[model samples]
Target: MTVQEQYPARYYARYDHAATQPAPVTGWYDVWGMSDASSVPDAADLVALSAAQWSARTPTGLGVQNGQIVSYAPPAPTLAAQARSALVQAQAATWAKFGSLGKTVTDDWITYQQALSAIADGSNATATDLPSAPSS
Candidate 1:
C-alpha cells in the first residue's frame, strides 16, 4: 500500500467556516469533505513517507501533496537519531546540574555539553555513545 494509504492525513476541520485552532476539530476531510474532496487540506504527515520514498531521512521525514511538501512526525528513529536525542537530554541535564554555578561550571562539563552538540544524527551513533556525565 502507498504511504498515504498506510498513514492517512488525519482530518481536523474547523467547527464552522470561521474559526481558529482547538475550538475543537469537526471533521477529517480525508474521510469527510466539503463540496469537493480534492480542494481543502489543513496539513500533512510526512515523516514515514520520506523514508519510504528514499532510503535516507531525518527525524522529520518529507512528504508532498498536490505538489507541495509537508514536514511533521515520522516513524521511529534510527540508532543515530536515538543517540542524538539522548545527547540532547544529557545536555539538558548538564545544564540543570550546573546552571546555578554560573561561571563556575567546570571546563570538562562545558566540553562535554559541546561534544553532545557536535554529534550529528546522520551517522551510526548509538545511545551508548552519549558523553559520560561529570562526577560533580
Candidate 2:
C-alpha cells in the first residue's frame, strides 16, 4: 500500500513520556522501525494520535511542554492562499461531476472547468472573482 504523505491541518503525534529516550516529533510522525522513519528526540514509539479511549479526538494541534498542553502559532494563511485553495476545490468537484457527462455537458460547465483549471495553473494563481459553479 502507498503511504499517506499529506497531513491534516491539526496533526498530532504521541510518544512514550518516560521511555524510548527521545521521539517527540511535531507534524507527521517521521520515526519508525529504523527503515520508514528517522529517529526522533525526546520521545519513543512515535504514533499519530486521532482519538481518546472515549469520544472522538479533535484536531487541535495540541502540544506538550514540560507536561502541559500548549498552543502553537502556525502562520495564518493569506487571502490569496485561501482563494487559490477554493479554486482547487471547485476544480475537483466540477471535474468529478461534469467530466464524465460527455455529450450531456453544457457549454457553461465546460467554460467553468476551463477557467478553474486556468486559475489553478498560470503564475496568477489567486482570484477574488471566480466563476460561479453550475447548479447542482
Candidate 3:
C-alpha cells in the first residue's frame, strides 16, 4: 500500500479518567504513536483489551480507560489577521515619531504609516517598503 493507505495522517482518543490527579478531570486524550501499528488502536478496543489483560490483578475503576474518539485540526488565519497586524505596526511607528532623530526618520515614519494603512484597507502594500523604527 502507498503511504496514505499504510498510515492515517491523524489518530484520536478520549479518556474516561484523568491521566493525572489533584486537578479537574478532562476526559480526553489525543495520542500520536511512533509507528502505524501503534497509531491504529481504536479507543473502545484499547479500553476493552486493557480491561481484559489487567482486570484480574487490578482494582475496579482504576488504571487507564478510553471513553470515545475525537479528531481535530487547527484552522488558518483569515484576512482580518493581516489587517490587524498592519494596524498594530502602524500604531507603533506613529509612537516612534516622538523619538525621531532627524527629518529622514520623520519622513520614513510617514511612509511606513502610509504603507500600513494601504495593507489594512486590503490594498497591495509590499512589506519591504516599510522603514525600520528610528533608533534615536
Candidate 4:
C-alpha cells in the first residue's frame, strides 16, 4: 500500500478541520477549513513523511518539497547499518552506565586535543625561545 494510503492524509486533515467552522461558499458549494492552521505544519509529521518518501524514491536519499531541498539520513545496508546501530547503542549504554565517568573522560580528551593542537601550531613556544629555533 502507498504511504499516503497506509496513513491517510485525509484522516489528519479531517481531524484538523473538525474543530473549525465551515467555510462560506456560494450557497451550493461548501468548503471545509482547518480549525487550527498552525497545527497543520507539525515538524515531526513532516519529517516522517519526508523520510518515507525519500527512502522509497530519492536516489540521494534527500528531497525537495515546497521549494527547498533537504538533506536526509541515508537508508543503510543490513550489515553496515546493523554495525553502526550496535555502535550507537553501545556508546549510549556506556554513557548511561558511567555518566560522570564518561563526562570526565570526554573532558580530559578535549583538554588533551587542545594541548596537542597548541603544540603542533607552536603556540606553546615563548618569544624568548624563538631565536633558538631558526625562523622558517
Candidate 5:
C-alpha cells in the first residue's frame, strides 16, 4: 500500500492538500473548506496523520515509529573512536593535575596512556577501563 494509504482518510486528504499548495493555506479548514464546521477533522487527527506520513516518507529505518525514535547503536567503538576517547581522558587527567587531587589524576592519566597504547595494538581492554573526567 502507498504511504498515504496507511493513514486515515482525513490525514491523507489534509496531507494531499498541503503537499499540493503553492502558498500556505491558513489551516486545514481553509484547504478542506468551512461549509460545515462539524465535518472538520480534529487537530489531533491531522497531527497523527502528518506524523505517520512523515515516518513513511523517511527512509526505511531513519525516523520515529510509534512515538519512539528508530536508532542503531554501534556495537563497538572504532579504532579512531578509541583513540579520540583516550586523548580526551588524557586531557581530562592533565587538567585534574591542577586540582588538589594530583596523585589520583596522575594515576588516571597513566591508565589513559595505557589504554591509548592498547588501542594502537588493536586491543580494547584498557580503553574500556579508561576513567571518565571529573565533573566540575
Candidate 6:
C-alpha cells in the first residue's frame, strides 16, 4: 500500500499540532494536508490563480497581435479540462522534488481523476471542490 493511503490527510492534520517529527510538518501536509476543510486547492481556484498571475506579467519578445488572439491557446475542450491538466503538470513536478514525499505524486494523480469527474459534471463553474494545486 502507498503511504498516502496508509496516512491520509486526517492522519497528518490530527498530528500536525502535536507531532514533533518532520514527517508531519513538511511536504504535502504543508500544502495538500492543511487544517482547512479542503486538503487541496480546487481546480477553479488554481486556474483563476494561474490566470491572475499570468495576467500580471508582461509578455516580451512576441510582437503584439493588436486585434488578434493574444492568449495561450488552450488545447482542451473546456476551461476546466485545461485547468485540470495544468494542475497535473504541477503535481508531477512536486512529486519529483521531494524524494517522492510519501508517494505524493501517486496520491495527487489519483486525486486528479476525481477532479476530472467533478469538472465533467454540468454544475456551475467554481473552485470550491477541486484538488490541490501541484508544485510549480
On lDDT, the candidate that comes out on top is 2
For candidate 6, give the lDDT of residue 7. Answer: 36
Of candidate 1, the 10-residue stretch with the lowest lDDT total is 19-28
Estimate the lDDT of model 3: 0.43
Q: Residue by residue across 100-133, what tens digits does model 4's lDDT show? A: 4644435443344344344435565432221111
Q: Model 6, range 1-136, lDDT digits (tens) per residue?
A: 4334433332211212232222121211222343453554332222111333334433332111221112332232575765566656655665676446664445655566556556645343675445555332
Q: Which parts of model 3 are misplaced by more than 4 Å?
A: 1-80, 96-105, 125-136
- Pairs in clash, predicted candidate 4: none
lDDT of 1 by residue, 8-53 (tens): 6433222333322212223333323233444444334222223233
Query: What alpha-carbon RMSD in Å does predicted model 4 have with respect to the real structure?
Result: 17.6
Which of the two candidates, 2 or 6, achieves a greater lDDT against the reference?
Answer: 2
Alpha-carbon shift of residue 81 in model 5 (angstroms): 1.8
Off-target runs (Cα >4 Å) in candidate 6 are 1-77, 97-113, 120-136
* Superposition error at 128 for model 3 (Å): 10
> Model 2: which residue pairs collide?
22-41, 22-42, 22-43, 23-42, 23-43, 24-43
Tens-place lDDT per residue, model 5, 54-79, is 43543222322333233323246766
| TM-score for each of the candidates | 0.34, 0.37, 0.31, 0.20, 0.30, 0.23
**Could you tell which candidate, 4 or 5, scores higher by lDDT?**
5
- Tens digit per residue, CA lDDT, model 2, 1-136: 2123322212246534663323232444433223443333333333444435113332554444444334534456654555468667766676677675653556777776677556656545555466677776
Highest TM-score scorer = 2
Q: Which order, best to worst by lDDT?
A: 2, 1, 5, 3, 6, 4
lDDT of 4 at 119: 43
Q: After best superposition, candidate 2 residue 29: deviation in angstroms?
A: 9.9
Q: Assess the local accuracy of residue 47 in candidate 1 as a C-alpha lDDT between 0 and 100.
A: 20
Candidate 5 Cα errors over 4 Å, as ranges: 1-51, 55-75, 98-108, 120-136
Q: Candidate 1 or 4, higher lDDT?
A: 1
